[model samples]
Target: MAKRKGTVFGVPVVVALFFLGMMMPTSVGISLGGLRLSVYRVVLLVMFLPMLITLFSGRCGKPHLFDALALGHAALALVSLIHWGGLQQGLESGGIYIVEFAGAYLLGRLYIRSSEDFRALARAYVVTVVGMLAFTIPEALTSVHILHDGIAAVTGGAPAPYIDQRMGLERTFGPFDHPILYGVFSASAFSLAYFVLAEKRLTNGRGMALVLGVALATFLSASGGPYVVLMMQAFVAGWERVMGRLPTRWKLLWALFAVIYACIDLFSNRTPFHVFVTYFTFSTVSAYNRILLFEFGTAEVARHPWLGVGLGDWVRPVWMSDSMDNFWLLIAMRYGLPAWALLVGLMLGLVWAVGRRKGLPEPWKRARHAWAFTLFGITVAAATVHLWNALFVLFLFLIGSGAWLYDARLPKRIGQPPRLGPPAPRLRPPPERLF
Candidate 1:
């Protein structure tokens, strides 16, 4: 494959739309036939039409395990919706699952085809973070949500006011629907920027600046989820150093031990993800409520067995506790264990794939590993935050890119065979006039 030049009007356009769309209401784009369309909804609609065209037309990227997994998830969501006696709602959710999640996933696979391409997309994402900070930082100091108010003035829905005081400081939700969602958005952006640096894709000073800038922007979003992510980023180097020194046998032993620990916890009525809930929560009370949320979550899974409680309002685990604060659990509770397992299997497959990629320089391998690290952190952090809007789309996007990287045979230039093989023999018309 030839090196690619990123285009503003191409794949990055989707990110641009996502960047702007989250600030406004669905009514801003269209209000017709009980369907409220926001910029993102419109973008998804437009993109999916072309995306589906390419997919069926055989002009898209190669499919992978995650692609099938995503489809299964959508199928489960549709079934749950229909089973709960909401055929109309089922139709609505089925459309979103297909067009929103699956569409974005394929788009990532089709467009982000190389490391350079990923770098371009990451640059665009960093710019989006700058825009988000422009709104949030002012809100933090002024105690006013100018960006929200401005969007509401035109979009015609009340802006979500999920802001709060926590950790003795005000939290800013910015363009996202909630503070925790905001954290996920910024944290993911920071992860991308960090990847650029770890890959040595950027000059030392510039890379350092970009990483810091993106990290600081997450702080401006002012949510503890981002705070935890940043902390993890800071420790990644140290952890890598310590872990890299272990013998292969020890690594295998550690993996076995972790599996055993998880099993013991599972039988004792606790699951592994709850560990994140305990550590990342804002308070002990909030942490305890999450326990209640999980108990409620698992029970719903038990009752529904296959389809789950349906795409209604989250079964309120307790009064004023509508938020599940965990994406994976919400899927299990609403869609079923099969859906949840597919998502987990996809994530774990990415970890194994990214780490095992061959024929790359150490820096390139480390760069990809950096992405895996953050992905793991984000998956764990989901126990503390919920997925929504652009953030959720981006999560699927990562899964798409990850799936690609996992098995991509690393494209080779037309004339250059990759790495080591005797050079293609220089052929010439045999000594003068053999012809």
Candidate 2:
């Protein structure tokens, strides 16, 4: 078998473009005189499309499990478009989310061709996150400028005067449009960083220092839901390591802790230290909020059991009196039960594939393990926040990359060897002619 040659520029270029796309300022919209382009949409065009072309042109290999997952998402998007209405309404609103997710999956499939590529991508992610945190930490401590802007943006237009009066201290939002979102994004990144650092020995002191900075960022972000999700992921990882098994008294203990924590958070207005300790000591309010939102969303699902009340319409003012934070609810509201079912099946299938392919080689196996837990954390986190965004897309790339790494290691099916025969025996006459 021929060994694969690594491209000097391709992978790094893709990683850089992706990180830039995520970090680019959306406020300064891409513009040409009267016309303005969204940074995100442009990012999709510049980063993802060329990469797809490269993959197909290179005949990289057959599509792997993550490819299958993208197909499933795309299929669901297409179905929603056809059944619910045309592209403008269905695709533009609800369908766009799926498209972005598929884009992430495609990018992941294209860039992650080998275990080394997977590791490199992970390192890039860690670096990008740490950089963001480095900027945010100083901003968080010195002034409330970032938080004020985030609140204003999240509220849509200017925030109400009363909102400022009520909160007293300014909320800390970091770089994101909302504080909660900032927290969620930071938590996921921090958790992944932890996993990456833990898996490999950090021989380089600089790498270890960066990981520590990321951990601090996670702690300070203070978004309740993601923090809880990270804790849960840590517990799951620890449990997986200990006893070499899942399902035991420890699971029960964790569940009980979660329930108790939620009860306390809901009923009490404790001090910051108390809240922090209680939140971690038990299940927490974040979990309870998810349950409530999911319930509320399900009730709406019952109303429109078949086709949903149009994409984006469910969250509109007329549909419900309150916000629906749960991801399942969001899906059910946009695409109805059938689409929701397809999504669930896709996620479950991915989880099963990761679990079944546990014995794959290094970096690949480690990546798969990280992805499985990451996805689990994502699922839990999504119950309290939207998972269809640029950050989530970045995450999908990591997951798809892991799947591709696994596929790369698998033995090829039986096939005939190349038919080029040994060089024809050199004749004495030929040798004399050469002389």
**Which candidate number would show the highest lDDT if scored against the true structure?**
1
- Superposed Cα deviation of residue 151, candidate 1 (Å): 2.0
Report the lDDT tens digits of candidate 1 across residue range 24-60. 5343577656556667767777887777666556555
**What is the lDDT of every predicted structure here?**
0.67, 0.58
Worst 10 residues of 1 by lDDT: 1-10
RMSD of each: 5.3, 9.1
Specify the highest-TM-score model's number.
1
**Candidate 1 colliding pairs:** none
